[model samples]
Target: MNNKKENIRLLVSLGIAGVMVAGILFIVGRFSSSISKNAMYDPPSPLLPNSPFPEGVSLGAKILVTADKTADKEAGVQAFASNDFATAVTKFQSSLQSNRNDPESLIYLNNAKIAKSQVLKVAVIAPIGLTLNEAKELLRGVAQAQDEVNNSGGIKGLPLAIQIASVDKFDKIKELDDQFVKDSSLVAVVGFGRDEKIYNDKGLVRISPGSPTTQSRQDQTQSGQTRYVFYASPDRDNFTQAIAEYIVKKERRTNVAICLDSAQAERSQAIKKQYADFIAKAGGKVTDTECNLSAQNFRASDFITKAITDGAEALLLNPRPDKIDAAIDVARENKGRLALFGSQQMYGEKLLKFGQGDVKGIVLPVPWHQNANNNAGGNNSFGDKAIKLWGGQVSPRTAIAYDAMQVIIAGLKEGITRQSLQKALSNPNFSATGATGKIQFSPSGQRQGGVFLVKVEPCESSQSCSSSTGYNFVLVQ
Candidate 1:
């Protein structure tokens, strides 16, 4: 009986040992499978799954990152050019992983973010009942660009997203406000006009390419809370100041005329006071200022005649659409005798209607060009690439808008937060190395300086009118 019992115990011990061995093998198999499935460090593939490039983005900027590892970067750029964003992104990712000491990688990474952000997830909440077609176009550009950035990979690992709510009027805006309050993914917003009160009420960050605060547009103080709201340009007074200075230097003329509608006329007068003071500082003169907003049958012939008679050598005219035509007519009549100077508003597609002949000798400052010196901003390729992306024809506002997007993306790549944005905007200075020249954001969020100047050139095969085109900086004279 004792022998039989010992045998039973031995058999049971053997069975337990066999089961333990099988269990160990099963665990080892699972561990190997997991590593194989998710291993990012496997013998680096020649190409990654997708180009690390962001989509719908065109940097046209040269790398500003450091120079030590140019080979890896060059390889990445080649991949990007070949439309292998995945491979490019992977190479960049690997380089970044190997060493975080490359500044060029930072630039490359930023570009990658821009391309990626386009592919990010985004939605739009455009204003309803837009007053003009241009507003709609502006909103469209913002939405499409945002959408492209978010779907790809966003900055770092964060995904980009947007939501759209259409509010036709005041009452409807109130309803949309309630909806906006509940959303969690809304990082920023672009509005139709400066409805700061409504924008602030919803905790939505606002950006407006066109201001509701422009002269005679509306009182921005109604929603004077600027903490969450940012502007693309300066307040009316500052913009006028930049224009005034450009006029004096580029034209080498002193006397100027200020013309506008009744409301805008009043604002123009106010701006004139500030500029007149600046003129004295610059050793220039603001001679013969004209403010006319309500001149229904007002003819430019008479105004030009009066300006010339008053000894005004340069005219600073800011009239409404019809008056703009009249002023150009008057300028045409003078023809090289009096130089016509116009406000920034004068640089638009509508000006094309005045006929190039009517606008020759007219000078204005523009915000965009094709081949600016590496004196603008970005990696020295911001302008031409933007033009190509815009299909050869682009507006000044378009370039500014693009730059604004760049600013946001840059901040994100640097670990974007609300605080980072404010830091960038406060004295935000982009080295002048691209198409738009050097861009500096003043404390107030205005592009601190101007690089663009406008001169009227004859339209193709036409003598009656001319188009306002941007000339090379060297060719401005």
Candidate 2:
């Protein structure tokens, strides 16, 4: 009887121990799962030692440090991240002494000074890791606006605080969506590639300064509708229509060849089709021959030969922004055999620098040009301010970004929340002064203006082209 009783007690104890072990394992599994999910959305801590901001912070080792230079800027970033604004200001000023052209450091220095008082926060989504130069141009515009606002007593006495979110890809924006939404102080977001739609769906006020891709006016949701997106640049349709109009009516070219990057088939095809439709309506035809610039076996000479054989009178080069070199190759091969036209992507310093004389006579539709402001009897106050701040010319991206921020600032005057800002911008009476002129948006959030056309020409001996290659994009008279 005693042995049997002992056996029963042992079985009960073993069963209880097994249940306890299972319970502990379940709790640990739940905890691990929660951490795994949070890890995907959480901003990664800075990899550099003693840096307080996340890795996505624009002013970190990933951006400021290189093999030869390391100390002041890095130290400034650490000080800024740790809330030592005074030390950060001193360190950044010292760092700028070495390189005054560094806009990243300049912006950080401005932010450190502004942090001493109440501030309204705004964020810019920059493609830092992917395209550093382009990202810098975008940031310069935002920085210029922030500097101007804060210096002039800020927006109703609250200084503007600028934050940078450097993203490598458009999809990476999704990872930041939750964090941005949670920050109630963030009034607006500027700059994105082709994926501003995510913010629109979430009802966040997003203004795209550089993206030419068009977005719909409204997004349908279960709770009725949302329309919190705005575009500062001209859409693809505007570009295609303008290019086609110029070719068919202005230049009188009836036969055209479409050359585009196959790797960016969606945007390329859309542009091709739109251009073709507009050309057809204006009495022109596009050659059926395929001119795939992204093809592995593509040759510019052979493509030009095929185009000539197909009775092409003009070539519409629609390569992706990154594939401008490929388009330049085609121009070199053509040797001005045909009239050349390009999309907005071609309007940059790269074309003048790399294409040189080969790209001369190429006409492009751009959002804003410095000459446009000059041609208007020196009316672009923003342009004058930018030149003074950066000590040189600024790109159309910078001009448009500056305008986007101006719009946000204008909206803030009506109210501070996202919903109030959206409502204010949506009103018909709303308008803001931009670099080029007055800025207004349509009901669909598109900029209410046509694009400017510019042509590449040789710089006169007396003219300062501001280009190393002696060619300049002069405003079309």
Candidate 3:
């Protein structure tokens, strides 16, 4: 009887122990799964799964994500990820030799050579899947800056290694904030949509390469506080103010009609208000009849007719980048009936190509013009170098992206830590020379500089135009 009772007790105890162990494992599994889901790592290539590219090409891929499976670039990416820096260097070099216009390969090649050494790192988060051309343009600028710095002995002998992150949506930025902030080696981040407040709250230094939205100034209520966001381009207020001044004061157009996409109401409204305020201050008025270009069954001809009927002297075409066609339609409908004034969004090769003659004489504000001779009457060094490096023309996005990197590099010169670099940049005395001439930030962290105005003109026979459409953006004299 005693043996039986002892055996029963032992069995019960063993069963209880087993249950506890199972429970522990279940809890741990849940925790690990959560961590895996939220982990910030390089995203997989955005290429289609059914793409003809082979399997090995997917590993360690960044910009080479779009390259073919058998390409030297793909091999280099795989080798680089596997710590085979020697193979990576050779393959990337071979890839570049075949296609000199591949800035992505050039950047990756430079990064591979410095993989074994101590380096200063910065990341550029561009909308790759969303806007491939814009993303490439932005990357080219950073690539040029990286190539220049690495070739010139890098930042105080520490090679600059750039990491490229392609985000398709704005929410991805929020998901990345924590991981990026935890990265001690990453000194700064350039590019991304206008989500400065998110980065600022996380205490990460974010530089806007092309976003024109004005950021909040550091609140005086928080003593000794610093805002970590900085703008490398003009803010909307400054940009609109410049355009408004040129219209009301330069062009002397008192009544201007506004046309914008209703899909982007917030941005359009803000821009309209800013322009109206500036124009009103200068004794001008925005027309009462505003045109929503993205509205259903919208007719550009009817919009233009309404503006003219409402006593509008000039038309402010402020369409979203995706809605350039609508803006072009408006221009085509106008047919020189009213002066065309465009938002900076219209400044691109698309305008020259699609709008053609209709877009001619449209004045738009740009951060930099390639032919503007911004280097104090000398050669535009940035433009010249960009042409040689990419073997083609670059847009304002590239110039500003280069400037943003230059700003970060400037901060790195003072110190490499996040805090140290932020302090250096936040200092009122801090300044950096960029492709757009002198770069200085206001107390609000907005870029302090006058915006350049460019007008579309026919490419003269004697002059080389960057646009293949035989039209170019000439610096407005």
Candidate 4:
């Protein structure tokens, strides 16, 4: 079968799929009016002012205080000027009771509340019951990024803290996201797009740093100043295409075994179809099977046995990290006859620790490799700093989380308001250098760093191998 060389890139473009989410953003009045009591509409809230006694609150003057019959609105402004943001928030809320549309009160209320908080709060909703390394790496990347931001004075001078919502099933996403939306201080969130609740909740901006989906919530980005969702790759389609390219262009595996975790079967079914489509187009045969699942006993060995019976020349394993062992054991038993392959889910330290040295060359497709840029150790490079800061190599999952934080930080720099952050993230021109390299978003909220097919290798290897990410990235079109 003669495959078109350009089809590889085309598969990526056509299958650059993501599920867009929709949301709502609530904003107050328009910008400032000419020659009014205030020149700027939204001013800064003091970071816990030690002393009070300022006449007015202004950015240019940094002081503007006025009064009326119910000076709650005016008292709030005075407290805001004095850096007593806690008092300012009290008065602003009292002011809102009298007139909810009070632009001045609404603006300072949000500001005073944010200023009074101990840290800038954000949420990360990740599924639990996955492997420890999977959860650990994701959390570590986020924590490291938070440390970097807080060390540098944080966003709007507030330190950062991530509230992790760990769920067991994909269906658990919405329930937790709804909980985060209730907290007004929680401006943005990062997690799985498969969390369907994120699709329903229109109050907080959500982002899936790694999970991929078939639909997108791009409409949420258009919402003026409320909630929205954004994508950051590992979309099932991209991974399938990447693997397909590798099978057709590199290994020439004619009949490949495609297996899945019964627990993850429903979630992974669509991806299996995508794999089938891509490989068939490339003229490679796909032999598919579903895993054996029990409430207490689910083994990939049974799945592998089925693949061998079907006469598969290669194996593609898609499972949560915990189930990867079963597949590796089977692939190793068959040894030279059956090749092993996987998706981004397989890119972690656990693969090395658990692969039993049997998966030395199992191939996987990932979005970022430490050596993707071919830099030894640039001070600003994402991978190098992570290794230096954390004292371990950075995985693509960690890099993606780091990049997600970088994206939010970039959006924070654009402006502190929720609406500003959404627009900044969705801005077609806005691109940032993250630990994963240059990151830009598509119109549908997909990150620009495309997928790369990486071959699994030992955690420690020779100079001939690039083991930084515990694997070597094979060049493919």
Over 263-337, each residue of candidate 3 has an lDDT whose tens digit, in order, gives 767766866787889889887999988688889999998999999999999999988776788999999999999
* Deviation from native of the Cα of residue 441 in model 1, angstroms: 3.4
lDDT of predicted model 4:
0.62
Which numbered prediction scores highest in lDDT against the true structure?
A: 3
- Taking all chains together, the TM-score of candidate 1 against the true structure is 0.56
Best by TM-score: 2
Per-model TM values vs. the true structure: 0.56, 0.82, 0.81, 0.68
Tell how far residue 106 is off in model 2, in angstroms.
Answer: 2.1
- Residue 367's lDDT in candidate 3: 86
lDDT for model 1, on a 0 to 1 scale? 0.49
Question: What tens digits encode model 4's per-residue C-alpha lDDT throughout 95-124?
Answer: 768854232344345546556556555666
Q: Alpha carbon lDDT of residue 440, candidate 3? A: 85
Summarize candidate 1's per-residue lDDT along 151-178 as a digit string, tens digits.
5555665544333344444455445444
- CA-lDDT, candidates in order: 0.49, 0.75, 0.77, 0.62
TM-score of 3: 0.81
- Higher-scoring candidate on TM-score, 1 or 2: 2
